[model samples]
Target chain A: MMAEQISIFIENKEGRLAEVTAILRDAQVNIRALSLADTTDFGVLRLIVNDNDKATAALKKEGFTVGKTQVLAVEVTDEPGGLNKVLDPLCEQDVNVEYMYAFANPQCKNAIMIFRFDDIDKAKEILAQKDIKVIDGKELSGL
Target chain B: MPIFDIDFETMPREGLEAIQLRRLQTTLERIYATVPFYKETYDKAGIKPTDIKSLDDLRRLPFTTKQDLRDNYPYAMFAVPMEQIVRIHASSGTTGKPTVVGYTKRDIATWAELMARSMSAAGATNGDIIHNAWGYGLFTGGLGAHYGAERLGASVIPVSGGNTKRQITIMQDFKPTILCGTPSYILHLAEVADEMGVDFKDLYFKSGIFGAEPWTEEMRQELEAKCNLKAVDIYGLSEVIGPGVSIECVEEQKGLHVFEDHFIVEVVDPDTLEPLPYGEPGELVFTSITKEAFPVIRYRTKDITSLNPTPCTCGRTHVRMNKPTGRTDDMLIIRGVNVFPSQIESVLMETREVAPHYQLEVDRIDNLDTLTVKVEIDETSFSDDIKGLQAMEAKLSHDIKEHLGVSARVALVEPKTIERSQGKAVRVIDNRKL
Candidate 1:
């Protein structure tokens, strides 16, 4: 299932990450998972927060450019071949994984991995056919 | 036409010309006798001060340029001795030198009086509190306006430039009636005020006398709506006695009325050097007639503008000049500080991280002029990490501000992102039409 994520454009400067985190903290929004993609000039910070509306409103009020995106949240086995199991089907189905990150789920027993795919619907269909556990936006953000 | 001759400012055109001719002759004689540069130039042209019997004959004199001022250097252009000079102001010159101008006691008095008259024309009264943000020191706008405001018996707050937040607080606290600064800086102030949740409509500002940089009617409307004041244009150059050379009346913000009593103004074709008739746009030239210390004769200002001889509705009979549209040179005035592209080039060339290729982009962002130096990333300096590139950008930006006294955002573009001409890459991309 698809989970919603937020991306923010931040200048490559000191304490920007800390500043962003401080805003989220003051807004009382909890960050569930995050990934940062950086280039020479700037960085795009992706965050899975408990409240997208609150986080976006707070960050935007502080003049941060915020954007919303859709990413898949997959629950893989906590074992060593956990990620390999999901990748094996995705690779066989000719799916492209643009980027991905993982975190231990406090809500469930298995580990949760977030993925950004070129063709998200194709990847979702492939995972659904394989009977892999895919967490929805509400459940993934809560974890 | 019932013309008011009660004041020196609104004298009839014929009467003004007669006074101008007498002053011009006097200035010519003084400069010829005092400054060797003028004496030599006048002698080289085989002309003498007495030869300029009429204003028409004054056109026969050779034009003085910024290069001429540079040739004289520190004080050779001073018509009076050092003992008589009271103040000196300078504008940016080529290759790091400055175009120096000195004012004697009388020259200073003249400047103050003219400035006061200019303020009066802008609807500023002695009761008004003027928040002067034009940077003081060598820049003539600050002190020139200060003395003028004082002369007019106005409460002058010499809050010279920068400290944006503090300026906002001062505005809210003092409730100044008049704002005197470059339009760009005033725009910046309004923006800062908005950020601080202080509205100008809630403040006591009634008029803004903006000068030192070219601004548009659009900017005028923007500032008026934002600051709740009438925005009027004031024109001046350091060589021509600073910020009191001309000003627009608040009642009729059509054109700036040139104070022809002090300076004999002229317009000439920049390319051909032929005098342009009134109502035709050309390079502005001035002969500072009443100036005692540094009286200039037909000084080419290189500012593109036209002259309007028609009388203004404000009852000032002085000929009005169109707001300066552009400069004939590559000089860029950022926040009333003049910056040339070559100056930026020297700063960028000093940095080993960036290649020699660069372009300067100037845009008015939120009413403040912003300079962006787009430097080509050299292959050797190209790094995979964002921190290093950002550091390089910071360094370049710092160096530019340190050297040029103007803030700039340094951007490292791709190797060949900047379009290159057949000969050299295009240097400046100015988006501010004003």
Candidate 2:
């Protein structure tokens, strides 16, 4: 499944995260999942919002350094082997994920996972060859 | 005394001019014989070494630019042989390749003497200890001041740059009466000194020489108040000798005095290259009369400043030049108009509501260029109302246009949203990829 991730370059300061949220809320966008990687001067705020296009447009209009990137969304069980099964194929293909986070889809019992890999197209090709079903942006937004 | 070793700082006008003419003749002959770049350029200009009989005749020669130095590469521009080069220093290459400059034994001695004169002009003496915090190695700022202090018979503490804790400890132990570094770093030092509860007033430092980046009088006042010391501006470039080309005297910090005896300075239109009258703002050009390894004539410095012929209150007969407002090379061309970040700083300082932390990002979308200024709001100006914030942004946008002659999109963020730099803060982020 394809996860639409919005990455933003944010100066490390108070209320910067809140400012992003406020802009998204004003544009009627909902953030489903989020993660943050920080450095001394700045941080990369990654988010999986319900409306990526609208969120991106609104943030850009307000002069925020926002970047849109495609990520992987895999559906796995909540058990121990669930993560290993999804990661084993990626590891075998020599695909390295920069970062990843998980969230359980409320509509289904399956866990919806997000990952940032070095080579997204290759990872997607390997998943397709393995008969892994991938969903679209519209399908994941409902969850 | 050898004319090169003559103390030009105290030389009379007629005597200095005569010395400059004689050195100019010798420099032309030497360069024409050795440096191919100079030889070709002088030949193209159709000027002979004998043509430079007076100070005015010096203009008939070709102007040397930083590009010429880069085009020559390595030591192509060095007039003297490799054996004579005692040292080399370079400018910070943030844009492209750094500009390289070399010094012979005599050139090094002249640099040390000028730096010593500059320090003495600023009231530093043999009895005073100096904490030279400017960076070392390739950077000329640290060693330029270091050699001067040593020549002045002062106890030199080469603290170099960074390591604020160690700098403060050494400052306390050494009791240095003079400091040298960029203005931004000095402010950072004062901040750390405050947080650490170090009483700066108790320190013996009486003055500081700041350069390597352009700063405003606002910054100078802020640094002075914070550090409890008088701040003086020192001007120079690796292209000409180093940090000792000119400095502020103790009696008045109005403008820096150029050591006109050893170095000749002239202001001319940056684009047309036409000589401008005194008191007009233009690019500063310099000719080194005493530099041996790398003697440059009519070197276009690209700094924008005006000249003051009036003698300084400090009693130095040398002519004074206004603090450079900005760089002609850094001027931004938006559509057809020219804009400078310092012009925007003037507008922001006048408003009294915006903090100095700001960045200008120029982007082109759909064949139209947009200037977006991200300014930080001071604590007193913070407002919760969306309407109030929008109104403030609109006001800033209008004011920027009125002052800088360019329409810009202004967005006021919370205090400290933009990054602060200890060195030179990148003011412009141009995204207009050609």
Candidate 3:
């Protein structure tokens, strides 16, 4: 199933992350998997959160430029070569992976890895054909 | 259907020269008789107005620089008395004392005719609805274009500058067929149109007359592609008679045709003051042959451009001038390499990731001169790819080196980071000497 990630554009300076996290704290939103893409002048902080609407509105209220992107949550084995399983068929099928990150849940046995592919629909079909479990947005957030 | 002032515009080369000589002599005599500054300068040079027998004799006159106007200040440069002078305009004086210029009732009527000819050449007509966005009052761009549009018999909307959102709405409702303003403000209007979800193409504009600042060909292509209209270059300054001094015909956008009937144009080597042959780039020097209140004698414009005496597709015989590269005052000498802000603007216009709004900062770091380009990143170009962002900066810096043979650091900031000026943008900041 499809999951959504929020991206916030922040200028490169002190206490920006602190201010962001404080806003999220006051809004009572929990972040799941997050990755920060940064350059010398600015950065984009991507996050999967429990309440997407709440987190987005809170961050935007403080005048931060925010964006939303679609991502996929897939199950990966905990041990050796765990990540390679997700990459193997997708590479053979020519499904490009733009970016990915992972998060662990207490109720789930295996780790849930988030994937952002060039073609998310093709990546979904490739994973489903291989019988890999893909978590729904509601299911992942509730966990 | 005929071009404006067909007889004069298409006059044979010999006849045009004869008229030019007659007008030039009359102007020289008037200035020598009335204006003390011209009388003193010409007297010191041991040349009288009658000595200018042919068109070539104009070379013997001295060059009048902008400092001369600034030195005279308010009314000392006027060739006519205050009773005849009806209007006065002054430069912004950003560097110090402002240079002032005056015009009489007859001069204003002549200015209207010249500007009307300039507008018609740029494809405006009596049937066209002209949206004049050039600032009015103290600045010549506004009233200069306004009087011309009225003279052209076109329905003119003197919206002036600013009030962009309302202007866009007026554009949709009033349905203007032509636009007149600076190139940068026109582009800014296009951007605002995009944000307002109003397509510029929907405005149904056929042509735009843009000038008062140097713009490159690449920028013209961008403005044309984005604004969906024929972009014509109109050249003028407050000191010369404002927005009607010269303009490019809509039929041939290649070069701007100077109104030789009223003014004489010469390209000269700025260093040696020797006039250069046509096709050689040099500082543009203009001599007002028909100005009554303020007659300029071989005034140096400090703008770098070449003259083309060849015939144009539109069939006018007046000499054409290539688009100016940059003003001498705006050129940045970086590490002994001359770089113009327009060159940097051309580079910025070439890429989609960067917006057209930018500022160049020159400084001395570690005893070596450095150039830094601060460009505003387009909102649509922002992405989560950190490597791609750095790569974009690298590509811009590399392009600057390739285009200008000078190294520079490119900084991409957030959208709207750079402040937009109501008038012309202050594009350069030199921190080295200061």
Q: Can you give the TM-score per candidate against the true fold?
A: 0.74, 0.67, 0.60
- Can you write out model 2's per-residue Cα lDDT over B110-198, one digit (the tens) per residue? 88988888888777888889888887777788888889888888888888877988899888887899888877667777878877899
Share of reference contacts kept by candidate 2: 0.00
Which pairs of residues have clashing backbones in candidate 1?
none
Candidate 1, CAPRI quality class derived from DockQ: incorrect
Score candidate 3 by lDDT: 0.84
Candidate 1's C-alpha runs over 4 A off are A1-143, B1-6, B351-353, B379-389
Which ten contiguous residues of candidate 3 chain B have the minimum total lDDT? B90-99
What are the per-model DockQ values? Answer: 0.04, 0.04, 0.21
What tens digits encode model 2's per-residue C-alpha lDDT throughout A1-143?
A: 57778877666688988998999999999888888876543466788888888998998788775666788887777777977877889899899987887777887788877887889988888878877656567777876
The TM-score measured for candidate 3 stands at 0.60
Cα-based lDDT at residue B222, candidate 2: 84
| Candidate 1 displacement at residue B347 in angstroms | 2.4
Candidate whose DockQ is highest: 3
lDDT of 3 by residue, B1-434 (tens): 34879988888889999999999999989889998998999999999999999999999999998778877888898999999999997654323245689999988998999888888898888999999988776778889888888988999999998788999999999999999887766877888888899998788788999887666687799789888999999988778887788889999899999989888999999899999999999999999888899989898888899999999889899999999875666766554344668778887778766778788988766434678998876546666666777888899999878766668999876555566578566799878642
User: Between candidates 1 and 3, which one is better according to DockQ?
Assistant: 3
Model 1 lDDT per residue over A64-141, tens place: 657777899998898898888999988988898888888888976788888988799999998999899889998876
